[model samples]
Target chain A: MDKESYIFNKFKNSLNGDDGAVVGKCVYSKDLFVEGVHFRREWMSLTQIATKSMLVNISDAIAMNAVPKYALLGVSLPKDISVGEIDELTNGFLKIAREYGVQIIGGDTISDEKIVISITIISKTKNPIYRKGASNGDLLAFTGNLGDVKKEFEILENGGKISNDSKFYIPNLKDKFFYKVAKFINAAMDISDGLSKDLSRLLKVNSLGFKPLLKLSKDELCSGEEYEILFAFKPKFKDKILKIACKTNTKITIFGQCVELDENTKFINKCKEHHF
Target chain B: MDKESYIFNKFKNSLNGDDGAVVGKCVYSKDLFVEGVHFRREWMSLTQIATKSMLVNISDAIAMNAVPKYALLGVSLPKDISVGEIDELTNGFLKIAREYGVQIIGGDTISDEKIVISITIISKTKNPIYRKGASNGDLLAFTGNLGDVKKEFEILENGGKISNDSKFYIPNLKDKFFYKVAKFINAAMDISDGLSKDLSRLLKVNSLGFKPLLKLSKDELCSGEEYEILFAFKPKFKDKILKIACKTNTKITIFGQCVELDENTKFINKCKEHHF
Candidate 1:
């Protein structure tokens, strides 16, 4: 197991193992966007960094079929940060929060060596989705195209600049689409740690395997920070899901089907872990 | 204004300027504890660090007269963290969580240069005590003794070690007393950034000033991380508050009364800012 999993496993009883933890009608989730580890100042602008930070967290709530209502930001800023930069960052958070109708509540700020933003989004949902409800023979699918984020990350790592509208900077979450399709989905989560690794987690929790229906390349399977929805549903609702996708203007890919764990079937995770 | 206030002022419309923001019946708050900025690893154990982290956040909820029901922890660990250390940190969080009956819901973990914990507490209160609502002539008071945290912090800064029972290591919150006296409080907040600074904020937001009933030392006025309650109440409830304090075994210090802002009556904050 990776270091993140190892530490969280110690709190296994309290953890819901979902995109966000559900309490009553509320879904609570937090995400960290730290300098150096998550992104470099040279790669993205302050607004872009803050925007991605909020969107990545909002993705968790969307995956749980929750509408985010409130946010608490923990911003650890460097001592020498400029007021203009702070404005850019604050506007970045406010812009996304306004778009999603999330209220910026109270939070703490401190001085640190780098910009470490930890945000908590509290969302409300009537029927929250979990990662353990997928049954055998359930059809597995994902929203949006994958593998582009990996190519963009490789370009940035190689000292090449990508476009201003790169997915790495601005992630597009399917909040409206997910809200429409939530009732049809049995299990759901966001694909932040690539398709292969996240898919394995979704299946392992249900003690299931996968039977691939479409060929997927390593790039498609291993791209991180996709922020797309990965969900499972009964085959009977396939046409209804397609109709909803069309109505919501969301791209859907039916990649595989959930299967009983067998010696012949292997659901391997070839994606590299994001954190230690 | 300080940098923290300046940055948060950019989003003034969304901020409630309270210990925890109240949305409907739920209160949400987030706090950051960064190594080197908040504490040093050599001075405190991992368990102590984790315990303080949880207590400080819980104090926000308590000060708002809300019972902490759920928490989301954002932990950034050093790359070289050991499994045993992780266990200690998790246990420390769990121990405090169990004491307050808070559920450890979900959080994110990442790798960084030092341990940075950002915790978000989601609490429920039927009637939250805000930093506003104090009127002229209302009495101001604090719970527990003040000035020890500043001395302890100075000792630690000067390479002097303190005892395991230091208030800097484990903050004793007046949660029970606050819950019992919440109805009597006109305005309330925890003294995290020392008495002078935090009390000035409490009064300034209400368009009021202070009349010092008792002379306060620099140490008492400027100590940070006291995590004690600073509140305002009417003179009619003063005796009732004192009786509740006696019943709860809490030390109550009535320091001043809220006064109309005047040139002669100044609420000078001599406390040094905790963060840039």
Candidate 2:
């Protein structure tokens, strides 16, 4: 087993092994954004970094059909960061916080060579969706468009200016849409570590496999940081899900279905695993 | 104003200006442990680092007289970390977690050059003690001894061994004693940033000053990471507090009292201020 899996397995009994930990009605999630690994200061402003940090953590709670409530931030900043930059970062957090109705409850700040922001979001959900609940023949769906983020990333990587309206930096999460279909979905998770990798994790937990029905681009299947919800449900809920998506103005696609593991079935494994 | 205060004051209306943020009966606290800033890898083992990270965050909850329930850890590990080292770090976390009965609910992990552990602990308290409630003439008391940690830290800095029983790594928290006097104490906080600096923060919020009655060494009042509870209570509760401390086998020292700010009053500013 890899180091992450090895360590996780040791504490699997105590852990729920989900995007967020469920305790009673509350769900807690944490995400780390380091300077070079997550984002570069040259590519994004401190404001954008702060905004993305809060939103990425909030996405986990949304994936679990929870309303984001409180946030605890831990930031290690560099010495050269100016007072104005700090204010901008704070404003960035407050802007996204106001949108999601999440209060910046507490945090810690220290000096370091690089920026590291670790945000922990606390939310509540009566019935949180888990990745271990999908069954055989369950139809899998994903929200929002994929592959566009990879396109934008390449543009920035090739010394090209990305459009200000690009969704690469800021993800448009369909939280309301997910909540509306929370009861209808069997298993769900945010596609942060690319589609194939996250789907493999979800299927592994349920002891199931997937067979794609629709063709997907390499970028859509491999590039990560999507922050879109991928869910599975019985084929019977297709009509209901479509109607909900239409009403909520969310774009969802039924790309695959859960299947029994066999030699004949096709299983995609093109996504990169996040190495720690 | 200093950078930390300047930034915090911008959101003071929404914040409690306490060690942890209070939301209903729950208190959330976050602390950052960055390599080189908080600790050097050469001076301590991974186990000691992990243990101290959890203990320091738990100290905030104990100061508020809250029972720690859940923890969210964010670790940015270096590439060179071995599987054995990770296991040792996990064990260190579990050791303190079992003692406090705190479950590791959720967290995030990533790879970086320096190890950064950001711990967010969620705790509950019906009546959380704040640092703004001390009235004029209120007696200030501290738990356990001081100045010893500075000596130990110096030893470690100079390639000397720190005794296994040193309180610098694992603080001897008087949780029972604090809970016993919770109703009687007016103000309280943990002395992580040393007595003088933390005391200044508490007094500034209340628009008051302190008059120390006992003589103290510079190391005792200035050197930080003491993690001892510094509290203020009415003089009428002195006998009751002593009885409770004695019953709990805790050492309590009455070293100062709250006073109105004036030119004649002494203000200790020898403590180091963490600038971010």
Candidate 3:
């Protein structure tokens, strides 16, 4: 048999309910993290590279209020990369997944022009929380501050100044804070395409328009990699949220709330006053 | 709500269940087809591109002995590629899915240097056939011939030599006879790497070696597009298989039966024999 055939056959034997078998519904989610678009390997350690690649989707699942369980990875490497480098990257990922109690189910390897890491995570929960269930009185809240990531992006892009505070703020403290806040929302989603674009999407899908109270600070507020999560809840669930937060020692921000359920989302932040 | 949130929220509302509405197992298989590595756009029509892309995966479910159900597609395209081109490409895939009674549930997209299509298929079946299931005394057989795809690949690779009847004849007949033949095999798999390589995968998985009576007259065959299936059967089901084939009007090739389990497989076809 060919080398490829040997690999596939090993994969085949790995299946079945024998020994270490774990099975669930057939799901697949892929994340292709390119060099310039996702991360720079220089600034981030291989551990961070593997963790960030996994966490983005974990955040997606968290926004859906689902428990992430399994992952499949596709790694495309340049011809010059070494086997040791590849193994280190995967080992880093393995360590993180084991930390989170998730399994590295399966993955693929291929040759590419750059390091394109395609990760697919399969998660489960009793009920998946979506962004469509917000009632008229729902309170729109965020897990952390929104605008700091754009500042980080600017710092990265310009190769300019990045405070230890700025670096520690987004990826370290802010990210940890949000993961805990994931399960507390009725309908939740992350602010990936900036608050403006993402909130617009939430409004469009829910078919509800809310006037956002955007009268806070404007700096680091416009747009950037705000991996922060924004979720909604009814006023009655506020106490439950508080209890969960208190137990976990996780901090959250209300940023804005569900002000109305009319047509077109009228949002407000430090940058713009509302009028729809 | 960004497009990501918008699309997901739509999906959630469409399928409402609290806590855990539905969560699927991530695919057991994931593969990539790249430009210059797999197929070129210059040769295949839009329909063929779509059909072939999805068809490459149809038997993967069969490879796992699972019922092929849903597909998640990841497509990366150049900036010059029109939206119309993408729509045409997707429509071709949707057409193929419909043919297989499958659906394209969900997937993501991004930009890339060359066209790269990565697919993950979710198959549903109670008792998924596995390559490791073939025991000693199991009769090894294939649903179709081996040499046709090799012939076709040669013709296509050599600048589409229309004058070469030798290269094209087998593939043309194969195109007509392939799918119907696919319905008859047990533990069937598509002949991707070639019978020699693929059979090696099968034997190793089953922990049994077999005689490869490959009556193939060609040497040095390497084509990534061969979708023919190979399978194993029990002696008790022999009459049932013949009856089914007779009724369905499909040919079943009894290549070589499994004699005793061995690490190395022996080849015997047309009174000639060899071992590796």
**lDDT (C-alpha, whole model) for all candidates:** 0.91, 0.85, 0.55
Candidate 2 CAPRI level: medium
Q: Which segments of model 2 are wrong by more than 4 Å?
A: A262-268, B266-268
iRMS values for every prediction:
1.4, 1.8, 18.4
Better of 2 and 3 by lDDT: 2
Which residue window of length 10 is worst by lDDT in model 3 chain A?
A: A13-22
For every model shown, the clashing-pair count is 0, 0, 20
What is candidate 2's CA lDDT for residue B272? 65
DockQ of each: 0.78, 0.68, 0.10
How many residue-pair clashes does candidate 2 contain?
Answer: 0
Tens digit of per-residue lDDT, candidate 2, span A1-276:
366666666556555588899887888899899889988887788888888898899999999989999888778788787988999998999999999998777787777788888898989999998877899999999999988877887787787877655777898888989999999999999998888888888888887877889998888888688899999999999999999999999999999999997766646577656676
- Comparing 1 and 3 on TM-score, the stronger one: 1
Worst 10-residue lDDT window for candidate 2 chain A reads: A7-16
Q: Provide the global lDDT of candidate 1 against the true structure.
A: 0.91
TM-score of 3: 0.77
Flag regions of model 1 displaced more than 4 Å. none
Candidate 3, residues B191-265: lDDT per residue as tens digits? 666665666667665667686454444432233344555678777777777676677665767676665764455
Which stretch of 10 consecutive residues in model 1 chain A shows the poorest summed lDDT? Answer: A10-19
For every candidate structure, what is the RMSD over all alpha carbons to the true structure, in angstroms?
Answer: 1.2, 1.7, 11.2
What is the per-residue lDDT of model 1 for residues B1-276, given as tens digits with 9 covering 90 to 100?
A: 478898778667645678888888888888999899899999999999999999999999999999999888899999999988898999999999999998888899998899999999889999899999899999999999999999999899999999999999999999888999999999999999899999988888998978989998999999999999999999999999999999999999999999999876768787667668
- Residue lDDT tens for model 1, A176-249: 88899899999989999999999999999888989999999998899999999999999999999999999999
| lDDT minimum window of 10 residues, candidate 1 chain B | B7-16
